[model samples]
Target: MANIVIDRIRKSFGTFEALKEVSLTINDGEFVSLLGPSGCGKTTLLRIIAGLETSTSGDVLIGGKSVIGLPPKERGLAMVFQNYAVFPHMTVYENVAFGLRMQKADDARVKAQVEKAAGLLHIEQYLDRYPNKLSGGQRQRVAVARALAVEPKVLLMDEPLSNLDALLRLEMRAELKTVLQSAGTTTIYVTHDQTEAMGLSDRIAVMHNGVVEQVGTPVDVYNYPATRFVGGFIGNPPMNFIKVPVTNGQVAAGSEPLTAPEETGNEVILGLRGEAVQLAPLPLGLEMKVRVAEPMGSHLLLTGSIHDQPVRVVLPSSETVRSGDVIGLKLDPNRITWLSPESGKSFPAATA
Candidate 1:
């Protein structure tokens, strides 16, 4: 029952608001990622929960107990920071046993806990090795091992893998999920990388402008974003947004018109991901004037325009396309996400 409930959490730095009345609930044993660009307050929110920073308002509860005024050490949670916090003077075993030892745990108890944690992190073989003898990834595992040795009610990680190289980060991402899932601890991870968030989290809380823009499973967030900001932020190249006119709950797409579920305004934004575009026969689909065709290894990323709006479409690399060429593009109307012009809120099941 190590669920966390964040109630109207707000934080301000004198004149600036870092968090704006944000509320979210993380279920027991569920992994939730606080995802956003830099300065969006993801790390601040995590620090508040960890009792490292004080919120200007709101209460934080862990396993139903209010933890607002509790010190980090009393919060029954453990944290792994962006940098590996392993002690150079200590071996892997000693580092993992630090927390247990600090609790005045006996020799046998410490050994058992350290060994268990090391095994879970796959660092049991390196128990006798010091930090200097370990690679970056191995050192990170030691930090995670130390946190897990204490068996926290909640595990908070702040970009723990960001410092690793790209290949190592990819490898650790897969391994981290396995280790955490086996631990089954309620975890809150803060990261700016969408791939990391989508890959590691059971649910993602996408933040923007100091507030959570949307919270959903990876598939839901990717395929069906809740806000214009979400659709724009979640993808690698981001979503392609075309401002279109809405008349009588209808908007023109390509060969057909798309109907809006609700009346937003005379103008609405239509969003499409790169995966949603396909090649179509000429005159039957919309024609895009190609600006540049980038070789994306598996496909050609055609940077072009449709109806005078900037568009990027993915085409099969086998297709012949050049900077001056025009490609026939067909889009699935059902996959289009409609966003409001007034509030930028996306309609329900907008992706469908």
Candidate 2:
């Protein structure tokens, strides 16, 4: 009943558009992350849903009813921000109790909800301490505990772990996923970190330049990106791109022959993950003049020029190749993505 449907939401700040007719749905008890680089309007859309910012056009609905005119509190949702937004003067217990208190809940209910939220966030031990006394991670827990104490229909988190250190950020990221799923609050999270989005979301809406480029499960977005931007943006070291000529419905990469994609064109951009390439024998269509070799514990990454495009490839660490070596590549034909060079959309050459 708490499912959220964002229906063609648009937002503008004078001459600049922040969200352009973006639409998405977050099922009840599901976690959906708005993910993209900075300035993609993810946060703007989140704020619009929270009613902290109004949409210039379009509607927002929760539980199948439009909430366009509702204030944030009236919409039955809670938001956790990147800054941890805790009051310096209040003890953790009081902070967690604030939302319930605002609702005029009885003291007993407030105490119970605050205690429950603190337990969920694992901050019970520090409830009596002020924000200044807590670590960065602990302060964030207070912020989350405060939000959860209200038992909202939907939870919106905006980069809530960004301020933490790298290791702490990882820890909190996993913890948030587990805790939020347990709470089952129908969460919508906004983050520019792909790893965070991948780890925390049931689905991710990838945004770009005020528009959602794609919306899919983490696996779908990673393995079968909808746009060329998404294919290059989602992966670590990212998906590689090289323009190759097509002849007789087949791709001739320097010397190796690739089965033609279903899309009819004289040329198609070959999208390959670095891990998809394997060292093979002669007749390779592309040549990488290795200029950099990185030993990545479990794998080796080589970066160089191939088909006049800069590319990186991953290989098993045991491989002995180094800079100046020309490693022949045999691409896993089934693993390749065929993309239209003109429109940048995938050619649907393969099933998801």
Candidate 3:
């Protein structure tokens, strides 16, 4: 395992700055994910670490040694791309052993390591099958096995499960985590999928427009987002932002007044997760005219508008509200977030 450190890395493509003095540290044996939307520089940062893209400035260190001048092969790291990229003509065993062969390991040692990695990935039974004969998940496992066969200090994955179906993606996620944990390889995974990042990472670095927006554990970033962009980006159904007029420690949504703990001198945006909005029995509350109601197994997703602003609410499936229903929602101040109306900077309430 290796500790990866990126110190003030900057990269530009023509006039576009891909990475703007981005800095982060991945501890030895830690699984850290770089998460953001497309064109947000998460992939560029990964490629820089893999030596596939050169940084305009700054340093990349592996195990306390700078690898700025090293080639990808000499960097002592393995990378897996979005596609499986397994050779269709090669058997699973051959694909897994390719890296070891490139490094000129003895035939006996290569066989042992290949068998061990395949077993670890639970693909040992399919070792003799060619890629064309394997399932999508099996092919993905072969790709991972090939990377593991190198026995590198670190592993880099760039949206490795994107090509798989939802069920297969979830299955591979569990399998990949197990294999990586057993091997104890330091891993840096890049993805735009917030759920995947939250489920797989020890910590996530949320990026935006070539800069690091927030870097924290999933809970920290979710519960106490550093910016409105993160609050809006990292959640399922996403967080709802209502632009409200602030006055005397209270914010008003249309004609209804909602209580929050933020000072009222500045115009602030109110943020509430879909789950935090309570469908209450009160007569007068934040009024939302439901536009669509989707039953998602255990819960119902209500997409509607509050004074023409979009709002999503996740309620129990048993609640029998339908489209075009005007419902009163009780805002939970304890779970609410306040952000600068103009800057979108988040200000979380203090815990008692």
Most TM-score-accurate candidate: 2
Model 1 Cα lDDT, one tens digit per residue, 54-142 = 99999999999999999998899999999988899998899999989889999999999998998888898999988999999999999
Q: What are the Cα lDDT values of the candidates?
A: 0.89, 0.89, 0.88
Per-candidate TM-score against the hidden true structure: 0.95, 0.96, 0.92
lDDT (Cα, 0-100) at 243 in candidate 3: 81
Q: What TM-score number comes out for model 2?
A: 0.96
In order of TM-score, best first, we have 2, 1, 3
Query: How well is each residue in 192-215 modelled by candidate 2, as lDDT tens digits?
Result: 899999998899999999999999
Candidate 1 segments whose C-alpha is farther than 4 A from its true place: 350-352
Give the least accurate 10-residue stretch of model 2, judged by summed lDDT: 280-289
Ranking by lDDT: 1, 2, 3
**Residue 36 error, candidate 3, Å:** 1.5
- Candidate 1 global CA lDDT score: 0.89
Q: Clash pairs of candidate 2?
A: 253-285, 254-285, 255-284, 255-285
Q: CA lDDT of 56 in candidate 3?
A: 99
Best by lDDT: 1
How well does candidate 3 score on lDDT at residue 267? Answer: 62
